[model samples]
Target: MDILDQLGAVREGKLSRRKFTKGLLAAGVAMTTVPLPARRAMASEGEQATYFTWGGYDIPELFGPYQEQNGTLPNFAIFGGSEEALTKMRGGFVVDVSHPCNQSMPRWVQTGLFQPIDTARVANWGDVIPELVDLPGNGAEAGKVWMAPFDWGQTSITYRTDLVELEGEESWDILWDPRYAGRLGSLASGGDAWWCGAIKAGIDFANIDTPEAFDKIAAVMREQRPLMRLYTDDTTTLEQALSAGEMVASMTWNSSAVLLQAEGIPVKFARPKEGALTWVCGVMIHKDAPNLDRAYDVIDSLLSVETGHFMINDWGYGHSNSKAFDQFEEETLAGLGLSKNPVEILNAGHFQQPQTQEWETQMNELFEQIKAGF
Candidate 1:
């Protein structure tokens, strides 16, 4: 079935593998990242600075403060993956702010498509985790960072506990397994997949730029290509497939597992023995943001404590705001694969390291070819 039909089944509670008392929309369904209706009355698209982000993040829950202050939610533009969003921006698509993970932060900055975010404007700036904001190419000047760290989480294996049998301690090798070959799914973006490929190849993130590391990663990715059943960035599509038992496991973010678990799916967001791919994604204002003041408000809203709780509990990501953890009990946080102390999770995983523009070009190019069975 097509993506829409799959999600339609999910929303209508028609997926037959198991019964989901709560539909996929419970976590606010992930859409195509196109122009989405705001939860509240939406102002004209031209009136407010647009928020360019991933599909699920465009929902109204995260925009509570932004809508309260502006009388309406800002224009929402979504992209299936970060690479596509960056490509569009590089091709003269100017947006008020865009979401990008730390893996692409340096390259996005090098494109000259963004400006440093003045931390003074973000009211919750001081509450953001220090390690998250301290990224490479984070602007030389203090208080002005290239990206305001918003949601951070791990990119790892989310597998079916009932459908698949484990061989030993969980590892990235699950995605490369020959037994689950045709039943595997994955995200199509290089940002997460390529880095995870490096991990699976036993390459160090700190030394991933070397020629040897690149070749080893490429060899492993090529080996796994033939085994994948679907490689799309759409969350609902993959999640529905998992719900229906069409695929056994997928390379997914923390949010996917949280949403799936809520749907009553017997899934585990595996903490692979090799290590999970940890990342921090946030907003960067366009150099010429149309509504510059409102753009700051958009960033501020995303960084707010209220949004932090939603991101952590509902979306299953580690929010930048430390205070957001106060509302949740330690036991609850552990269940979501998060902690009150952000560093505990961030440091335990393979935190991403930024690369130069050239490395990005090479990785993207090579990955595209590999995905195409080249």
Candidate 2:
């Protein structure tokens, strides 16, 4: 069968994931042998904007309105991490829009690669959470917004309710509990894992760069190492492990719990007594974006209540648009462990703050060493 047929079979469960991947590899090799113009022509099919973002976000569900209006999904370029995306952009890779979180907004603004977004162009501007839009460095001047906040959520322990028992109110300390040692997982990115460690260590994130805080956080992470089964940023991998009962618990995003619950996996996303690590992520227009108008359309679509409903109801994240919360009932919000007002949920957690480049580098390096059991 052809690549499309093979892909269909994979989706329909007629083909194993291994075989489908092999088919894709073979198809990619065959495509490389095609003429350059043919390859370029193939890539140009209904392409409106080029979206640079994390892997899972390239899906059509987040931009349904854009697809319906434009008759195509934006071309996507996936990045494993924000730093990788920035490095590529600096290396001259041009994309109409890029996604980054509040913590990285300051650094991204300093790069001067993004321009201020005209909120007047975004139809859903007034409906968006003001706190998210007013994130540090998200605006160049009074009233000129930069990024259009799209998604907000927490990173916390997701445990198998059937396999694990709580000794007290849910907390980050569970990852260090010896009872589940060797059955736990964590995100590989220090950007996330390090902050979670700080929460567990009782370190103030605003003062996280201090020697005392660094040392204390490092100790907490080192203690967690031996207890972990793996360290990875791939949410699918962690969710699969949880589904197969291979892992009792792991550090994961809100989406993991949503996905697992849909599949009838007995998972619970912890609301740690110390507080969860929360973040607001959004899209920014590249300074030299070729499809500027299309970029605005994409942002507006993302901010729509339709997209917001998908983000909250399907992905277990808080949509930036306040009107999105109106679609759900109080009981449903409570079941998902979310608040009707995004600000209340954001305030309840240890919201991530911008960190200095030096501090980020140091924390990443230290976390890497600890993960290596050093």
Give me the runs in candidate 2 sitting further than 4 Å from their true place.
1-6, 9-47
Candidate 1 TM-score over all chains jointly: 0.89
TM-score per candidate, chains pooled: 0.89, 0.88
lDDT top scorer: 1
- Tell me the lDDT of candidate 1: 0.83
Cα lDDT, all candidates:
0.83, 0.81
Clash count list over all predictions? 1, 0
Kindly report which residue stretches of model 1 are placed more than 4 angstroms away from their true locations once superposed. Answer: 1-41
Q: Per-residue CA lDDT of candidate 1, range 151-265, in tens? A: 9899999999998899999988889989998999999988889999999999988999999999999999999998999998877678877877889999999988987888788
Query: Candidate 2 clashing pairs?
Result: none
lDDT of 1 at 194: 94
